[model samples]
Target: MSDTGSYNAVTWLLDRNVDEGRASKLAFTDTVSELTYGDLQKQSRRVANMLRRLGVRREERVAMIMLDTTDFPAVFLGAIRAGIVPVPLNTLLTSDQYAYVLADCRARVLFISEALLPVVKDMVGRLSDLDHVVVCGNDAHGFKKLSDELAGESDSFVTVPTHADEPAFWLYSSGSTGMPKGVRHLHSNLAATAETYASQVLGIREDDVCLSAAKLFFAYGLGNALTFPMSVGATTVLNSERPTPATMFALMNKYNPSIFFGVPTLFSAMLHDEALKHERGGTRLRICTSAGEALPESVGNAWKARFGVDILDGVGSTELLHIFLSNSPDDIKYGTSGRPVPGYKVRLVNEAGAEVSDGEVGELLVDAPSAGEGYWNQRSKSRRTFEGHWTRTGDKYVRDAEGRYTFCGRSDDMFKVSGIWVSPFEVESALITHPAVLEAAVVPEADPEGLLKPKAFVVLRADAKTQGLQEALKEHVQQKIGVWKYPRWIEVVDALPKTATGKIQRFKLRDGAR
Candidate 1:
């Protein structure tokens, strides 16, 4: 595990499990099938052999458009085992976005799931650098079948002696601001997150079972379902279908997982279900974690009251690969993102690059061991985000006297009202606390005098009356936080715009406000 010696992330994640007598342990279970640690290692080796057979060289990129199945881990780790870089794309993106990423990474091979072929089926053979297409299911539609390709290859290959600092994989950002940018992470970065956040905060053990509603395409889910569980040979439950309140509850009741990873949006929806009010049998969730967005204090408290388990709210970004500031089991704060994680440092700075005092909003910058190298094909942006060892998180936060950081809003989402800065998250948090509100988003709109004021977009509960709801919500917000921070205009909608990872796209709302 030394940085100076030969190292491969797959060697530590996949091979180490087999070497330590966990070969027969259940590694992954999907809706259709299951894979053991022994089978995962062997299949990964076969995948390495198949990639080499297809003229894919070391350091070359392979794009993965597969779903949350057992094949995902094998292909991902196999590429790392053969010293090839794998780029896992968000399956929910449009065909144009898929084309942009496939062409951007210049991936030599594309491994896609059968059901998702329609998204990029027309783009096949159109990308300049893409040479081969391999489908992971039965109907290949004239493309190479993954099972057929693996049948001809041997399940024995040597682990490439890659350097610890070598580029292992690429994760494209969710494009909350604009187009997606590829973030490069090293071989050591995977293990760094496991050792710090996974080991210290989650305290994952060998006997634990994990089920993350987040998918593998996301950085949060990649660590939660793949690296974290694999780091200790724990069992992981994978669901390919969309995660709803019913689906997630069914999986939890069936698997009896000890740990669950989810975002704030899903947690809020699950809390609204009447089924959650009744006691479900065989639910053994010991610890639950929330990321991708801040967990509302009311939602967290309500969840703990309904089911005697806390949702550890934390803050992380694609640039950092995983969470660097999180609430642990011992220290439970409902609203604030807990103190800096072990082996990481965080600071808040103003526009002039000076450190901000407590109770003042500033950008949150992190210096972590798992920080990404930089954005691919983006020099100016790379320099702007990755400054020496510090990576700007693009989030505005205020630190309390006790050193807990509370999220304000994104730097771009913050605006001034009455010459005072207004945090959209703070206002949105206040709005969602009302009885009629299900979800809320705040954006700044110019008033008649060309002055900016808060405008809110809200989704109401199923049975709530909307006749006088706006006035009721306005008065409720004024009483909760402050009178000046209430939204000047409120519009109830069916849903809010969000990224594939469940992050609200406030910039889109800003455009509509204009």
Candidate 2:
């Protein structure tokens, strides 16, 4: 199991699939099309050859602004095959947001879907390093159509010989604190992530059909949908749009996938699904995993009761590439973000970098197999995060007596209310425990008295109303945890703000709280 530089994930899959005569075992399927591993390699090589023809060199940035589609995997793996670093951008972001990523990464070329041409066109003059814009369906100004370009190209490519430390791709942070920064992953980083998370933590089976609600632009989604299943020779479903509960449920029925990956927000939505109760379960999903944020125990228990499945959650950051610590099927703990995966170490430390006692909250630091090289261009942030080698995830956590890690909240998310530290998750979880509450987000806001107090925004049950529910929910927290932790004010909202991967955007809530 010695790590080597030549071991890249794509190459490993190509060799295994080809060797085992499972090259055509159908790696990717969507409503529109299906691609086997053989088809994946073919399209990947075609895109790689096309990139080489377009003069994409080693270490160049190839940006993709597209929804989750069949072509995404082709271009993504193709860029890596050609030794270019693929930077997948969220199609849902504004042109200005996309412009920031292009400028920050100095992306040389961008491959965008025609659906997003309007957005990309707005930033054309602003991007200095951008040389080409390859549109997926139709041609634009000085841009080639992906379909036309690949139509005549040969389906063969040479895998680039990359060092273990060589950058393979640059995925961006969620931009909760500021504009998203690019987190760079090396070639072996993908391989290591596939081996560590998929093999050890996920334990994905060859027969398992995997599906992810998170899009490819985000690291967690990309790993679950593309890298993990491909590395393990499993099948995956690629939904070409954002998934609503209904959409996801329909797809589950259509594909009958056994393993599902989603965020806590999505899981909560499914728990409220009336369709689940009426239709019973369509597909017998063996396992479901949650990431992007801590899964409230209330949500987990609700989903399990409704669907006969446990929503095992894990803690991960774009910086660490994927989930480094997660709960497996055998070791399911109801409330904790499980133990560290194989080849990784977890330590909870105080401000001075000293380890905290068990059950005490501290900043979480991870020593993982797939730690990114550093931020793409931010050396200062890089220095701040990388201690010797391990990346500081900036998340706060506690390890209990049983060695299970309980996620407290983000380090930056810990806010002071009346001179005391408060973890929003702790308060939010307490609020959701009320039967009338569907979901809740806690933020610190100043009261009329000028003292900061915890404020809660909640999504009530369909039969519940905001008028009486707010005061009761506030008192419920006081009765459960303490009177000090009770939210001074409560607002019932239809929904909460979330990132692309469905993590609560705490800073947004904090803005309104202020």
Candidate 3:
């Protein structure tokens, strides 16, 4: 796994699995079909041959709007095997976002699932760079069917000799604050994450089974269900439908997955789900991880008490690929994000570009081995985010004397009230500790005097009464954290706006406040 020299990620992730006598092992099981390690390699090779037959030259981009099925891994790895870059788009985005990304990356081919064809079917002809539209499932709708195309191709195409530093894939930012940016990742970056976080932190083994509630399009999910499992020839479970508590519990009971990956929102929802209360501890889940947002201490502790397993609440971004700072199973910290993984380094710095001391909040910067190369077209942004080896995470955090980091808020989400900075995450965490609150988002709102104060938007539990709940929640936060951090106003909402990855869109809330 050297940084230099010729290396194709597919060689290590797919080919080696078969070469080591794991060809017959179940590599992936989707809702519809199962893929063995033998079948995955063969199908990926066929995909490489089909793309070449369709005149998709080396290094050209291919956009994937498919779900969390077996087809996703075959296409994703196949493109990289053939030296083509695959851009996995979020399936939940609007048609305009798909068109923008297609045009932005100038994707030559689009491999969309049959279920998602209607989302961008009308705009297919409008994309000038798009040469082919291959549907993954049935009903091609006058377009090319992927199964038919692969049928005529050979399953033994030689993998293209690609450099470790060459671009292999692209993941768009979840765009919590603004438009999604194309984050280009190199071939070496994939193994770097597997070796650092997956191997060291997760301690993934070949016999383990994995299930990730996060979709394959997300960075966290991509690592959880695809790379980490594939790195050790482990099996993974994939579900196409939305991840509700019922659906997640059903999968756990059926598959008995050894590792489960989820976000904070899903964990909170599952905790409140009464119907599935008897299904707890039914799975073989030895390790659970959370990302996409900070896991509240209350939610983490309750989950552990019920499931008899600790949730390793970590933080990761699309820019760095996967989690660099995470809590390990041995060292469990309920409130703070755990120390950095063995291979990664983290630092918190102030506005003056100086490192902050313990207990002082500052923006976090990470020097990760898996850091992306740069944004696809935005040069200024790439320069700002990736400075030499250090990448700015744009997350505000405070380090304790013992070296654990606690999430404060995003850099733009933090605001000063009465000349003191107030963290939206801190207030939101406090609000969630209340028994009546299911989820909460805190944003700064201007008062009558033109001063900013914490304003909360909360989603109450199903059985909780709304009468006198706002004041109760305010007092609860005031007592838990401090009086100065209490929300000035509270709005009971059915749901908060979130990105595809389950991160609350706080900026959208701030926009409405104005």
Candidate 4:
């Protein structure tokens, strides 16, 4: 591999304002705990020293099971500085799910936070390769305290020289079908993703205050919160708990940030909050972004109308470790995801790997430096996902004449209904366009006549679940997309099952439809 003329992930972040000797520049929550660039450098070096002392070697996997807090970046960058790969585990995973990932990644050093200690203890026996369990808390059983180890260590450590192809982090694929697979990403790939997603697409500035609704474990959230902000000299606001609409609103009011990164579900809920709408337009919010799933056109319009700001939607995957295509703030379209980011090549291809005609639906393939090296420990699946330097994102999309990409749905979510192929995302998008529907998921349901008909699971916008509204919504779909695509059955559900990253779990809708 040739040199990309770039520093690895750790050096790239540390070089920003390291000469100034300031770490916490601004006050956080009216407290002095805010981290500055200089503080980041010192903590990262100390974490690197701690990892090296704990016998962590280059390319060895260290699993982190913690919430989004100040320690996350220190530990993550420290591992990178020490030339070790950090595998962040999803906090929401059950004992079995956590055990499987730990066993599969073969992580020798497992770090746990106090909040997640109970589940970590349940899987401790199942993880045979795990030699250490460092807890970010007070005295804990069967674990070393993380706070005591990094107290007085000198902030002077040398970064190990690592090849560009050396593993930097291991992200797991979102397992919609079965168990998730480990994805190995090189340091070069992470750096490339930071440049493309933060520089080209987000155009994030150093003075920007960034806060993300997605968690730290998800790839989208990881890039948006940590990597993207660090690429520039931006401050990231991390909330360790789950982000409810109330929590997000209070944070925005308190922090007064410029950028808010979230999924469509979060955006839609924010639009409905009267308190948020009343105070948002008076604020200085520069841009809002939606990703990890398609943003409904109605949600985009609703947010824009309320805040006088457009919500730029994008598409990305864990396999790629960052966003592939996104709508920039200056050139955003309400409904469509904009063209691919600079330095990335995107194409819609058919089953034979040939380019599809314009306006034709096919799998979205991306040729970017950000794509993962391959799936860890699964060579066959790796071959299928990574082809000839391009990563095949398993999403079906259409390219318009202007080169804008319109997401149809996941390739697996597109199924035949009455001999016509239907995209669940498209149907759900249409259903939400109706005024009464707050959220919706479309799936194939078998009719009494043994035919698969489109079914919609909907959550009413308000307490307006009157009989008049349901019939009007069914008619609205018929008028908008035509009779063939209309959902034959509509179920008013209170809530939809969602992934930890805020993606709607269509598999649950499919099962409920059946």
- Model 2 Cα shift for residue 427 (angstroms): 1.1
- Candidate 2's C-alpha lDDT? 0.83
What TM-score quantifies how close candidate 1 is to the native fold? 0.99
Q: Is candidate 1 or candidate 4 better by TM-score?
A: 1
CA lDDT, candidate 3, residue 354: 100
What TM-score, computed on C-alpha atoms, does each candidate reach? 0.99, 0.95, 0.99, 0.95
Q: What are the runs in model 3 whose C-alpha is more than 4 Å off?
A: none
lDDT of 1 by residue, 99-188 (tens): 999999999999999999999999877999999999999899999999999998899899999999999999999986777999999999
Better of 2 and 3 by TM-score: 3
Instruction: Give the residue spans of candidate 1 off by over 4 A.
Output: 275-281
Which ten contiguous residues of candidate 3 have the minimum total lDDT? 276-285
Task: State how far residue 270 of model 3 sits from its true place (Å).
Answer: 0.8
Ten-residue region with minimum lDDT total, candidate 4: 24-33
Assess candidate 4 and give its TM-score to the true structure. Answer: 0.95
In candidate 3, position 417 carries an lDDT of 86
Candidate 3 structure quality by residue, lDDT tens digits, 1-514: 7767789999999899999999999999996899999999999999999999889999999999999999999999999999999999999888888889999999999999999999999998999999999998878999999989999888898899999999999999976565789999999988999999999998999999999999999999999999999999999999899999999999998889999999999998898888987777455789899999889999999999888999999999999999999999899898889999989999999999999999999999999999999998999999999999899999999999999999999999999988888999999999988888888999999999999999999998888987888789888988999889999999989999998788899988999988
lDDT (C-alpha) at residue 467 in model 2: 66
Point out the higher-scoring one by TM-score: 3 or 4: 3
How much lDDT does candidate 1 score?
0.93
